[model samples]
Each structure stands twice: as C-alpha cells, then as structure tokens.
Target: MSDAHVSLRDVTKVFPAANGGEGLHALGPVDLDLGKGEFFAVVGPSGCGKSTLLEVIAGLTPASAGTVEFEGWRVDADIPDGIGVVFQEDACFPWLSVEQNIAFGLRKTALAADAKQRRVRDVIDLMGLGDFAKSYPAQLSGGMRQRVCIARTLVTQPRLILLDEPFGALDQQTRLLMGDEVLRLWRQTGATVFLITHALDEATMLADRIAVMSARPGRLIDVVQTNWPRERDSRIVERAEFGAITARLWKTLREESLKTMALKGAGQAAEPA
Candidate 1:
C-alpha cells in the first residue's frame, strides 16, 4: 500500500441529529488504500453509509475524523484536481447534446478550444457514444445517457474515478453491457477506479477487490479479491469462479443486510401508534 493512489486513515462520518436525538454514525474508522490504476468496489447492505464513504473519499463532504490522501497529498476542503466523480442520479444537462455535455467541465479549464474539442471527441469514442454525439440526454437510452455522464467526467482526464452506482438505474442486461463499457474505459484510461455498488455480480465482475461493509455504522467487514486478469471482459462471469466470488461477497453482506432490515423493522414498530 506504499504506492497507494488513495489512502484513508481512520476516516469516519457522523451526521448531527436533526432534533435533540443522538447523531447518526454513518461511516467510519476505515483504513483502505486503493492502488493506482486498479479497479476497486465496495458492496454492502442498504443504509450502510456507502454513499457517505464515497463523499468523504471524494472530499465532497468532510469526514468527522481521520484523513484521506491522494498520492500522498491530503484531501482538504475542495476536491483534488486529479479526481472525478459520477453519481447514480442522471446529471447530464437536458438542453445540451452529448458532445456539448461532455465538454461542459472543460470550460473551467485553461485548455484551448481545439484541445477541448479533441478531448471530448476522444472520450466520446472511448465510451462508444460517437453515434450519439449530437443527441441530447432525452434522445439517448438509459445506458447511453449514463455513458454521457461518464464521458463528461473522462473528458477532463482525471487520475482517479469515483463512481457511486453509475449504472444503478439501468436494467440488468443493460447494466452488464455498461459494465463491459466501463471495463474498456478503465483499461484505456489507466485511471484508478473506486466504485460503490450493491450488486454482488457487478462488484465481482468489475473489481480487483470488493470490500463488504457492516450495517449502519459501516465498517469494512471483508475484502474479497477477484483475482481477475487485467485483460478480462464480461464473459469471465461464465466461469465457476465468478459464482464462487459473488457468493462469497453475498455471504459477507447477507448477515449485515439482515441486521439492517431488523433494525428498521424495530424502529418502525417502536413508532407511536
């Protein structure tokens, strides 16, 4: 982990109570080091602070305690320059075409117009969105629109990509296809990817290592190494090892998920009649 691209030391997040109740302990005391140019995924039960962990790592929300460092540099109030983030929600500008939307973030950079155009064009091709360059988000299918969102981030050439269920909204078939697209993009860009997902199959297929978390006060419960070859594609799932890996990931998460559900059920039962 000495050559880690992103390192977290005792990172934790606690949201203060809205009323006079105790603060919600969302995430924490996590110590993980994601290697440079590798794909890592996190899977856990619902309401297990998965998104909170991603926000803290991205510097979008401040951690209540501990520190996050990117390539030895401490992440502070602002998101570091070499990182890009994509969320589950569709963020594409409806009014803008695919190419225009991809170029949006580049406007804040000092790159020349021609350079910006080239960058956008390259990412469009990379994400296989060349056919829909002029199409707006509404004109594209769910998968294509997600590609646009990812392309928009890639156009900026970030060294680290943090994806929080980028394909969460798509159907299963489309989700697997999008996973192929992501694998291609990850190999091509050579950027480190940190993904947060709930799908065991997705995590098993895409990640070099999958981290499973505990219930509400989310902590890393287990880390399963996929040991997938770097040159692999989606077809690898056909292998028996894939099922074993997914089953292992689910095994670690199933207990935590039951815990989460029971806690919710109790909370509901305790509410005033």
Candidate 2:
C-alpha cells in the first residue's frame, strides 16, 4: 500500500581491508526515502561514502548494518532486472558496437526481438547516439562513450537508475551538455534516478531534491529543495535565489570538505608497515 519506491532504513557500510586489516567505516545509520520517479541527488566531499552508498543500493555491496528496500521488497541481494547503473567510467564493452552494448542485458530477457531492437533504437535516439550506434567503444569521444553508457542503461528500462558521477571525468562544457541530456532522458522515461556527484552546480541543475552528506562515516546532513522551475536551464544558476541556495549548501559542505582533508592527512601520516 505504501508508495515509497526506495527506502534506506539506517543503512551502513564498512569496507574491510583485503589483507584483513582494520575496516573503513564508510556510511552509517542513514535513513532516507525516495519516491517513484524522483530525481534525487547525493552530494558530498571525497571519501564521504557517496559512491559506496550508491553501490549498496545497487546491490553491488552489502550494508554492514540496517536495511535497504526497493519497491517494498528487501534488497539484500542482486536483482538484475530491477535496477540499472551508470558509473563514472564508460563501462561499455570495447568489442561491442553501440547497439550491441545496449542490447547486451536485454539478451537474457523475454522481450521479443522487435521490442529489444525498439528499445535499443529508442535509447540511441534519446541519447543522441544515432550516428554512433554501430561504432565500437574505442571510436567514440569521452562524452560520446558516456552517452553510450547511459544508452545501455536506459535501453534496459529498469525501474531505478543509479548514476555515480556519470559525467565527472568530462570537461565542464561536456558535463553541462550531458546533464541536459540526462534530464531529457529522465523526463521521457520517468525512471526513478539516484545520482551521486561532487559537483554542486550539477546537483542544483538536475536534481528534484539534493541530499547533502557529511564527511567520512557519511551521514545525511540536509535535504535541500530547489526553488527553481522544474523546467530549468543554465540561466537558473544566475538567479539570486540559486546563489543563496548554493551558498547555504557550500556553508554546509565546506566544513566537511576541510575535515575530510585533515583526516586524509592523518591517514597518510599513520600509513606504515
């Protein structure tokens, strides 16, 4: 009866060293809820466990404690059909053409051949990768490769999409263009999106609501609502209200960023056999 599409009840994650040394407490006791079709953004400083949190939701990593539920069912294990993920890297297969890469996951499904082709074609056009549909991953530009990554995810038509800094490696101009493209895809597909990014401007530009996280052993600090119009453009960043919101978020994030830096320094000092 509840409509909560994704719920994290006090979820935590800790990574143990491969050599069985001390564990890294990444995130903890974080309670969050995401409604269906919501464009949610998580922003935090490096090592704040933003990416780890996303991996938890994607079922790529298990939580050290607490629970994660997707669409009312516990997500303690991988359920491939229910989720799609786009990482910061271009994860497309080098040997596969753009269309083949998009169709890779669909091969296991019961979808008709026409349906699969239609889905692949639709996302190719949606992502503006029409001309590059037959190209291998090695042939595309960085931005174009990322678009292929997105198209591969979208072609599967998963109910939830997790994006971990999908454009972080790109230049500012390409990132902005890709941001618009992502929004356009979300609008057309109506998929619930959870994106993790370090870029404040991208968060403000793309998210319906932004969840701010604290430094190491990450916790939700605040969930800021954007006052900008749903139909947003780069010009929205020029508004006084936009500046105000970013300023407040910066106030929250700056302290955490500095704290993380100090922790990193301490970590470096203590690193030894």
Candidate 3:
C-alpha cells in the first residue's frame, strides 16, 4: 500500500504481570496498512485484543514491540496530529451541550473563534445533529450520543479516524442507520477510517476491507475485501455479495472464537479450586 495512511510492522502489546513473572500477550507480530481515504475494519472474537490494536494505532497505548506510523511520521509516546479516536464508551462532556462538546477539541488550535465555530457547525450538519446542537448527552438517545461522539472527532478534521465499536450499544436498526451516517461522513470528509468491531454485518456493510484476527495473543489471520464501491450505503446489505462477504468474515471469526472458548475452558480446568 504505497498510499498507506497508517502502517504497522510486527506490532505487539504485552501487559506486564504484577508478580514479575509472565505477561499477558495481547496482540501481534501483525502487519497492516490502511490506505489514504480507505474505510478499513478489524473484526475478532472477545479478548482477542481488537481494542488493543486500535489503541496502539491511535498512540493511546504503546506497543511492546514493533512500530506504528501514520502518514510518513513515526508515532510513539504521543498521538500524531492527524488522528482522532472514538472508543466504545461515551466520552462526551456531561456538562457541555452538543455544540460545546463538539468544539472542545478545537480550543487548543490556532484557528480563530469564528473558524472554530464554523468547523463545529459543519460537523454538526454533517452528522445531522443540527437540531440537537443545544442538547446535552443526557437528553439524547444512544445512537444520537454516538453520533455526537463521532461529530466531536470529525470537527478536528483528522486525516485518520479510529473507531472502536462506536455503535456497539445501539439496537440493530439504529446500528444500520448509524452505519449509513458513517458512510455519509466518510464520503463527505474523505478521511481514512480504521474501525474495530465485533459485528460481521456492520463490518461487511461499512468497510472497504475487513481484517480478521485470531484469539488472544491475537494475530492477523485474514483480510477480506468487500469490493464495494466508495459511494455506498447500508442498503448494499440487501445485495448478494454483501451476504457472501459477511459469511466469509464469519467463517474465519467463528474458528477463532471456538479456539478462544476452548482455550478459556482449558485454563479454567487447570486453575486451583
């Protein structure tokens, strides 16, 4: 991927053990490259270090080994300038209104007040939250709040956006609708999106390519290209190829999941009573 917006080479993360014995090996030895303006996603079983992978790419967490680079710059110890991260949990400021929360990240920028406001307004309209600009997190539904979170990230005009199951808490219908919103955002903003999700359908519908990982001590097992057009929406799921893509993702993921469950059972069986 010559136009790689984000690149990882042999990236791995291991959590130090409190007893100074062994560590919990979470991720990789994985190599991945996300192209500029591409919508890429990662899907894996629970505890497979999917979130760890996202955090490493975002520079929120350091990798024990290997390198992560974004847009030709090595990223270590600090988040790169052109990256934004949205996690599964709600991060909106409780005290701030929708507009204020969205503008919070821009405060430290060199842009003038009018410019900041304009950017915020543009994102608000993009996310379809114009009606709720005055509303707070408590006043919005789950899907709407997630949109607000994404809107906040978009206001900064990041070149790469990393989303960790941002729509995980929403209902199925809401998740599909929010997928459409994300598609619109991706098309309009032309930003590279790196999403980590457990939902095969969502990944199938939204991503240009989907990477599957093995169970903990996570490894990149496969990458499936959706082969959909850049200008696409949730309705594409109704197409035959959508089902085939989702099934392919599931096939690999299910194997990993079963292996994960067997490993967990074996671990429990070996534990002291």
Candidate 4:
C-alpha cells in the first residue's frame, strides 16, 4: 500500500449557484502531499481557500475535479472515522457534561464500554479537564470548551487530525498555551495534523513544514521547512531562527494579501450600479 497519509492531486472545488449562474471556483488544480505523522500547516490571507482545502481533505466537502486520497484510499464522501476534526467553533453538545461530550463519539463505535470509559478518562486527565468533567459547556470558559472539544476528538485515536483556525478565538496567551497543548497531544498520539491558520507565528512554532498559499483560487506558493528541534519550549520562539522563519512567511503572505485586496477593489469597481 502507498504510504502517503494525505494526497491532493490537482484537486479543484467549485460551488454552483442555485440560479445556474457561473460557479465559484474555490481551489486547486493544486497538488499537495502530506507524509504520515507530519505536522503540516497551511497559512495564507483570509479567504484564500485554506479552509476549503482542509474541508476537502476531511471529506466534509467534495472536490469538483481531481482526487483526494487519504491513507492510499480516495476520500470521496463524508468524513471517515480515521479523520478527526477540531473546528474553530466549540462543537460540544450543550446539554452534556464535559466528560459526556468527550465520550460521545466513542460510545457510538464498537469499543467496549469499559474501554470507552477508560479512553474518555485518560483524555480528560491529559487535557487537564478532570475538575471540570462534570461541568456543562455553559459553565466553562472558551479555552476550556476548546480543550473539551479537542479531548473529544482525541479519544477516537484518529490517524489524521484536521484543525481549522482552532485557536482563533482565544487571547494571545491562551492561544500559545493551547498551541503547546496541541503539540503535546500530537506528540503523544503521533497522528498526522493539517492545520489551517492565518497566524504566521503559530504556524512557525507548530509546523514541520508550512505551506503558504496565493490569493483567492488559492494555489500553493511556497512550502517552508522548519528545522527547529522537536521538543519545543516557549523560549524557542526567542531564537533568531524563529524570527527569521516568521519574517519569511510574513513576507510571502504580505504580497499575497496586497494582491487579494487589489483584486477585491477592482471587482467592486467593475460592478455596475
């Protein structure tokens, strides 16, 4: 069997309108390959199709053309069990307690009750949600809610995890803390991750390689490899290489952001009153 964990071969997605008008072309004719157990990050300006790319990989949305393969099989339908997703929104069920929410997916599968319970408890403890396990979603802070969501996903032991702007709602300090937590979880699980974020610094800190995209109808502009040590501490960000990588990504994105803005302005000017 082929070893590529995730592969997008000239994939393209277009959204057809209800009125039979011209469709919106969202992505690809782009090629991407993610090796097994790699922490890959996709970074670009907002609306540059990064999230769309993630959705295609997760099988949440289908591509209009080309192929998406995960673990040597084509991803042609709804999300499969081997893939876990953590979206920006807190997706926990409101009525369930934190522990119940985390255990929800596991209970639906074929795992034994005892095994499910053990997995849920282990994730709750790992995520530091032991004290809040009995608390409802309404009782937790935003960061806490996100942690519960992540723990829920982790309990499934997925082969690939897709994170779409997972820390976008948190404050800077909390975002950093959550990033560290996510890194720890990935290391523990050894699952391949494909993260979508606009934060260049976050990408620089977490990614084994960062894929930078072009403006709308996004294409891969560059892929930057990060050679930093695997055991990253907070102080690692202070290193000269950290700033250098951040600067390189920023510079690439800056040009794309400008082009996107200019294209948007031109489109608005062309619209007839």
Candidate 5:
C-alpha cells in the first residue's frame, strides 16, 4: 500500500500587483510529495516562498494555479482536518498552563474529560514537558515554550505536521535539542512532517530528505535523501557524513541565494515600464 501525505503538483503562487504595477511570482510550478511518516525539509534563499509553500499545503493560503493535496484530496484553501501546524512565532498562550496549552486543540471535540486528560498528559510526557505541566508560558524558558507549542500541536495526534521554522528563533544548541524532540515525536506518532528551515545544518541533521529551492518563483531544484541513520542525536554533527551532506546543502543554497540577489538587483536597477 502506498501512503502519500502531501502532494503538490505544478503549484504556483502569485501576489497581485502591490503598487498597481506588476504581480510577483512567489512559489512553484513545482511538483513534489512528502510520503507518509516521512520527515521532509525545504530549504532555499530568502523570499523563495518556502513558507508560502507550507501555507499553500496547509490550505491556509490559496495557490494561484495547480493543486495541493493531502491524503489524496485537493486541499484548496479549506483547512484540512488532519494536519497540525507549528509556526515560528510564540504560539504558547501566556494565560494557559503547560497542560492547558497542550489540550487547546482538543477543546472542540466531545471526548470525555478523563480521556482528554490522558491525551494531554501523554503528550506532556512525550514532549518531556511533564515536569512543567503546571507552569505557565511566561514562567518557562524559550526552548520550553516552543516545546509547549509543539506539544499543543501533537496532542491532537494529527496525521501530518507542518513546521515552519519552528526552531528558527532558538540558539544553535537549543535548535539541535528541539530537532531531536521532533524526531522522537515523529517516531512515536508516525506523523509525516514537512518542515521549512533556513539553516542548512539543521535541515541536513533532521530531514529524511532535503528539498532545495531556487530563487523567487521557487522551483524544486533537487531532493536529496539523508538516509544517515534513523536514530540520530546532536553528536552526529561531529561525524563526517553530517559534514558531507551539510556542505552539499550549502553549495545549492549559496548558488540559489546568489541567483535571487542578482535578480533582485537587476529588477531594482531597471526603470519601471
């Protein structure tokens, strides 16, 4: 049996003329798929629409052309039911305790109170936030707060998780720890993860496959499989294989980044028509 989670076929996004001039081409005309239980990361130059792609797939933003599918159906702006999203911003609610935040996703459901408590408790322990279950977001450190954000998303047991730079604000060491946590959750829940990250090392370290994008009007330049041991830790950074993949990731990133900058420069230098 085949298990494809999210599929984008010739998906393109174009922003309408901002100052009544010309529209901006954002992402796609790119085709890609993230399989079930797969950890896929997208990396590209700034403004390459990495987050746009995630948004499109999540059905939060509409694509101008083509299709975004989840679990076999086209997800064209209606929020899909089985997908969980964690963004870069502070998602933890200041007023809610750790347990309360984690249970937020299930509030609409009719589950019995005891069942809800068990689900919340399980995710708290799963995320290693059991110790702080009673702590509020304001009382927690940055990393711990992010863990709460993630646990909140996971408590619903979504089949697919879309992470948009969920660890971008953290320090390098903290990001590594969070990457480990994400992998652990993926293992436990068997959820497909589609992540957008700018850090090449972070992408290389955490992704099962890395999708590299080009300049604006982002296209799938290539997809490289990590296949570097499923059970990984931050210590893997010291190994030679990690260096090899990360170096290659940088090579693609640098080339695409330069291309985008050059295009931007030329566009700015040209007089408006």
Candidate 6:
C-alpha cells in the first residue's frame, strides 16, 4: 500500500558459489509490509539470511529479484534521508567524541552549524548521554557505546530505522536495559522500526509483529502478532503470555534450523520454498 513505510515483494538475494556456477540462493520470494511507525522484528536461524533481508530493505545491498519500496518510491543504493541504519557492531569512530559521532551524518547537509549541533545535543540528552557527550568511545562501557551508536542514528531524524542484531554484543543485563532504551526511543521518535534478532525473547518483547524465516533460501514462514502495550519494558517477559509467544517462536525456528544443518552437511543448497 502507498501508506506502507516499507514494502518488499518477492524480494530475493543470491550469491555466486565459491567454486562458481548456478550460485547459492540465500534468501527470498519474501513479501513484507511495514506500516508507518510500527515496530517489526525478523527472526530465524543463524544462516537463514536475516541480515540479508534487512540490508536489502536498507538499500545497503541490491535485491536479486522483485521489489523494495519505501513510501511508494523504489529503494536503490541511494537511501533517502528518511532512513537510518544501525548494525550489531559499535560503529563509533575512535577519533570522534560522543556528540561529534552523533553529528557525523549531518556533515554534508545544508543545516546551519548551530542547528546541527543542537540536533546532536538533543539526541545525547534523550539517550541519557548528556554527561558523556564529550567522551570518546574508549571512555564508555559497551552498553554506553551502543547507546552512542543509536543516538547517532536518531540524530539524523530518520522516519524508518533499521537495526540488525543491535544488542547482540551486550551482556544479558545490558541487553535488557538497551531493549528498554530502544523502546523509549521508539516512542519518542515514532519511527517505523525494523529489527533483526535471533533472541526470541527480544522479538517477543519489542516487536509489534515478528516474522519467522525458514532455512537458507530464506522465506518468511510465519508472522506472529503480539499484544504488548506500546510502552514496553523488560518486565513484560514476566507475563505468562510472553512465554507462550517465545515458545511459539522457538518451535517455528527449530524445524528450519535442523533442515539448514542437514543441507549444509550434505553439501547442498536448501531448496527454496
């Protein structure tokens, strides 16, 4: 639909095999629609092309077939200003301080210097980094570093934010805290959030809907909607309903994971579904 913030129809990706010829189909014939300002998650086994799906949506990589559109415009390598992306790694540059890194994306923009700096300060405050705005990445803890990365993306004022396993490197406690932080940011920003993660609990807690992908030649096998309130917290997992949702996610993922392992063992590509 035209109002969809993001859309992917029959999207697919393939890579040439190491020895050459025919190539390995890694993902798709996937169809997805992300509504304006919705929080969505994609989950699957390790080699199931979760990141590939995200990158295609981000315009970081081209889809081998089908279409990707954002706000009725077809997506290409040139991502529009309305999009922001955060990967699993802490992408903060060593030479840049917290505020400087957050403002980096605005470097080539036409915004006035003071206005650009104001945007950076706003995000730092919003992310609870007011104290560390002048500190370098080396001065922060892992969780704090990730917060800086997120602030950097937020400062860009993106309408659609894509995160690929953004908290995968954090400790369990920190991951929970970061997840809460992400939700708060989402509420404040009202961006369409698309997160990719292997943690079923994370998906259950943060996603309005979660799509489960099948084995490589990845296809979205199912999409599960949750009833979590818009204002989410880590404690949501304490609810019995949360456990049920996570259990269902695990059940869908396990079958695909076993199939992927078997195919890899036999030196064969997973058949496209």
Flag clash pairs in model 6. none
Score residue 46 of candidate 4 by CA lDDT.
Answer: 84
For residues 1-273, write the lDDT of model 4, one tens digit per residue: 256889889898888988999888878778988988899999998888999999999999888998999988899866777899999988889999999999996865898889889989999999999999999999999999999999989999998999999999999999998999888888889999999999999999999999999898988989999986767755668889999999999999999999989989999999998
- The TM-score between candidate 2 and the true structure equals 0.95
Q: What would the per-residue lDDT of candidate 5 be over residues 1-273, giving only the tens digit for each residue?
A: 235678888999998997987798998898987888899999999989999999999999999999888989889899988899999988898988988898998987689999999999988888888789898999998889988999889888899999999998899889988888888778878899999999888888888999998988899898888897777766778988889988888888899999989988898889586
Which residues of candidate 5, in runs, are more than 4 Å off?
1-3, 18-21, 263-273
TM-score of each: 0.97, 0.95, 0.97, 0.96, 0.93, 0.95
Q: Comparing 3 and 4 by TM-score, which wins?
A: 3
TM-score of 3: 0.97
**Lowest summed lDDT window (length 10), candidate 1:** 74-83
Assess the local accuracy of residue 147 in candidate 3 as a C-alpha lDDT between 0 and 100. Answer: 87
Instruction: Name every residue pair that clashes in candidate 2.
Output: none
User: What lDDT would candidate 5 get against the real structure?
Assistant: 0.88
Candidate 3 vs candidate 6: the TM-score winner is: 3
Candidate 4 has what TM-score? 0.96
Model 2: lDDT of residue 89: 80
lDDT by candidate, in order shown? 0.92, 0.87, 0.91, 0.90, 0.88, 0.90
Per-residue CA lDDT of candidate 1, range 1-273, in tens? 667999999998989999968899999889999998989999999899999999998889999999999999999656888889999999999999999999997977899899889989888888888889998899888888888889889988899999999989999999998898889889989999999999999999999999999998999989999889998888989999999999988888999999999999999999999
- Candidate 1, residue 219: how far the Cα is off, in Å: 0.4
Model 2, poorest ten-residue lDDT window?
Answer: 227-236
